[model samples]
Target: MKVMTVFGTRPEAIKMAPVVKALEASPHIQAQTVVTGQHREMLDQVLTLFEIQPDHDLNIMKEGQTLSDITRSALQGLESALERFQPDLVLAQGDTTTAFVAGLAAFYAKIPVGHVEAGLRTNNIYEPFPEEMNRRMLSTLTNLHFPPTAESRENLLREGHRSEDIFITGNTVCDALQTMVANLPPGRPPELSHLPPNCRILLVETHRRENLGEPMQEICRALRRLVKDFTSVEIVFSVHKNPRVREVVFPALEGHERVTLLEPVDYPVLIRLMRE
Candidate 1:
């Protein structure tokens, strides 16, 4: 069985890493990894942490690329890979544009798609922006659905998908977390070099389009209040790569004492930071 696992963002990579590893270890299955490069550096960090070498990297990320651009480019690139590999089934994780495109491309090619970590829904399509919409659409196109919990499986059942095709496989994030936690990298990352020993660390991250502008500024304001109220607590924010997010975040959080703004860290580093 030839199974090509497709993903793009860091979260998808983290959750899908264990699936890829399991596929690689199976003697009867041939696994191919295809990365869409939607996340660029952050995506690469997860791949390296999991020791995953992709069979093909689409390199689709570009400066200021919109969702439409990503959809068009990923669909075209994956089509080429499908034509070349002709795999028996395609596997996509989560609700990113890359996963949706992977399913759409596989559907167009008359190949079955196995959706890992499937059937997650917020009911409101616009809450998570395109992700919620993507999840709903991907379920319609999926053949095999691997929902993480009974709740998620119920979501699929409510949507009229066949029970035989749905399986409760649990989430891969737990597997990945266990692996990373067991073999945690030594010492504080250079990103946290300046932090004093044993002081409280308050982590922050805001990436959704809905939280931009005023909402983001409000979050920064609350962080400032936290810093002002708690002298012992230090703030460590992992800024998103998107320029629009940075524009709002950097202005509000920059130049504050004990508030350290940083680029995205490696998966293990992030885990370690959270642990401390």
Candidate 2:
């Protein structure tokens, strides 16, 4: 059987890497990969790290891209890829716009969709904006639901999906982590150079679209207060490329001695930071 895997963005790529590898290793299945350039630079790095050469790349990212922009572009691009591949099953991972578009395209083509990392919900629709909605909608279109935990499987069951269709596959991020860890070089990566040997460290990575403006300010404020109170503690914030995020993050945390702000580091660097 031919299976097409669709994903975009760094997080989605990272989580799907192991799945792609597993699919390639399977003797009975032929796997194809399609990428929508939802996140250009970051997405490329993950693809390079995983050594995945996509069969199709829909260069859909645009400056100041709205959710509608990404959704529409991906839908159109995936329609063509779906027609070309004509796969028996379409697989999408996580809750990105590309994933939703992939499932939608597969539905239109009368092909079954296997949703990886399916059935995850925050319940609050706006906490993560379209992502929660994206996954929920994908669940409706999913023929095979690969939920990470029994809790997520229960979420599918409660939503009236068949128990047999919902499989507890666990999180693929853990699988990707194990692959990265096996290849890890010794010692701290250069990205964590600001660390003092004896200092307590906090590594932060947050860029949810819903957490912009006041919520972002509140988080910055809390971090400021944290560093002020704890003399030996330091904060390393892996900042996002969004101008809105930078506008708030830089001013509030940049000049502070205890806080060190850096651009998004590679997954290997992140794994080490999390380890240390």
Candidate 3:
């Protein structure tokens, strides 16, 4: 049967790349990748890292786009793709807007939906905002729930989902890590490559709009305290492009000798940097 994988965002692509490879390797299965391009540039980076050429690119990103906009765009775009591709099954990864909307579209199309990295719940709906709600709704429509861990499987069970349909496949994030790191590029930045041997490298990413004000300030204060406490450790933070995040993180981290705040690094470089 043909399997169409719909995803957007870098993290979803990383986790789904292995599934795409597996489907390609299987003689009976044909895997088609569809990217919503919710995170146009970053999603493309992961796609290149995995050497995946998407069958369809729904460039749905818009400035000042809200959650409603993403959900509507992905649903409408992926619905057309589902009809055109006429796949036997639809697969989506994680709790991204693209994933949730794709699953919903497939459900409407009466195509079986398989959710990868499913069953993750903060339970507190608003803590992760729409993500928690997205996963919950996706779980309702998922014919196959590929939970990343036994704990996640148990969580699905507690939510009254069937046990037989839930599969405890260890987190595919680890699988992606193994595959992506094997062919990592060489000659990284001098600042990163020249760090002290075996020195701890901290990677910080913060981009939730709700945390822009006080929470961000608190995070900056914590980092400043951390740098002060550990003078020898090195930090390479990839600041988000959001002006709000930049405004808060940069001013707070300035003048710290050990911390190097830089623009976003590509996937391979970020992976290599994280490994060291």
Going through the candidates in order, what is the number of backbone clashes in each? 0, 0, 0
Q: How displaced is residue 34 in candidate 1, in Å?
A: 1.1
Each prediction's RMSD to truth: 1.5, 1.0, 1.8
Cα lDDT tens digits for candidate 1, 178-244: 9989997788767778888878989888878899888888999999999999999999999987777
lDDT, each prediction? 0.93, 0.92, 0.87
What is the C-alpha lDDT profile of model 3 across 8-95, one tens digit per residue? Answer: 9988988888898899889999888899999988888888878889999999999989989999988889989999989999999888
Q: Each model's TM-score, in the order given?
A: 0.95, 0.98, 0.94
Q: TM-score for model 3? A: 0.94
Ranking by lDDT: 1, 2, 3
* lDDT tens digits by residue: candidate 2, 240-265: 98888999999999979889898989
Top of the candidates by TM-score: 2
Error of 2 at 234 (Å): 1.0
Q: Tell how far residue 252 is off in model 2, in angstroms.
A: 0.5
Clashing pairs in 3: none
Clashing pairs in 1: none
The lDDT, on a scale of 0 to 1, for candidate 2 is 0.92
